[model samples]
Target: MSETADTLFSHVKPEQTGYVSGGLRDFFLYRDLGVAAATQGKVIAHLVKANMAPEKGTGWHRHEAEFQIVIMLKGWARFMYDDQETLVEAGDCVHQRPGIKHFLFDYSPDMEYLEIVSPADFKTIDVEPVCPIPDPTPWN
Candidate 1:
């Protein structure tokens, strides 16, 4: 009897995968690969890794037809709304409703997080840039 290919299994190595950085330590995994959503019965969501500096963060933004779930993987950050603010740390999570005015502020040097969204093709919605990237060296 001969062994069939279906019985073969291999381990995946992390180093075999590649990562890309956007700006000043902000990196994104799967920035190049596009997963097929229709096959999975849902849209593909990408993982974003932000190792931001103090006072570094995303500008106020929203999505027209998608909801966002933000989970703090490490360090601390502040989530700001139009009239309120919430401080979140590792293991904390927040869900932003579609069309809400909000922003994230990284108050620590080692802040990291994950953002999961539905209909993953969604992009920023009429966002007005408020927080500009500060000088990288003085962030420490």
Candidate 2:
């Protein structure tokens, strides 16, 4: 059997698969975009939506990957990138540098975003905070 170049083609419809638990975070739901298999584990793409209100948020941690980007699709989110407080809202994109320690402290209830990362399997290691994080605003 010969493999064709079109074998890499991948199309995922929103109705095909629904969000499920057991993702990297418990407070969020993930929807796989089938990019990892199409790219042969070279990359992974998925949509993450908020499942619960942000409380403690993702502690200071850095991923062990070469590239990572988060595109906010709905609502808004607040994160601490190193010593800076970065607020990413809809229509905003964040290209997190390799191994940059950060914390996602808060977000809206309808928050949803697209996340693409190099290497399907990446490790997240918790690290010490570079600066104090501000308190999360109460969700109305």
- What TM-score goes with each of the models? 0.62, 0.93
**Candidate 1 per-residue C-alpha lDDT over 1-140 given as tens digits, one digit per residue, 9 for 90 to 100:** 88554333333344643446752234223332233233242343344454435344566777754666877777666666654677878899888787887666545556556666666556675477544433333353
* Candidate of highest lDDT: 2
Write the residue-wise lDDT of candidate 2 on 1-140 in tens digits: 88776439899999997999899999999999999989888899999999988889999999999999999999999999999999999999999999999999999999999999998898999998889988888878
Question: What pairs collide in candidate 2?
Answer: none
Superposed model 2: Cα runs more than 4 Å off: 1-7
The residue ranges of model 1 lying beyond 4 angstroms of the native Cα positions read 1-16, 22-41, 51-56, 127-138
The local distance difference test score of model 2 is 0.94
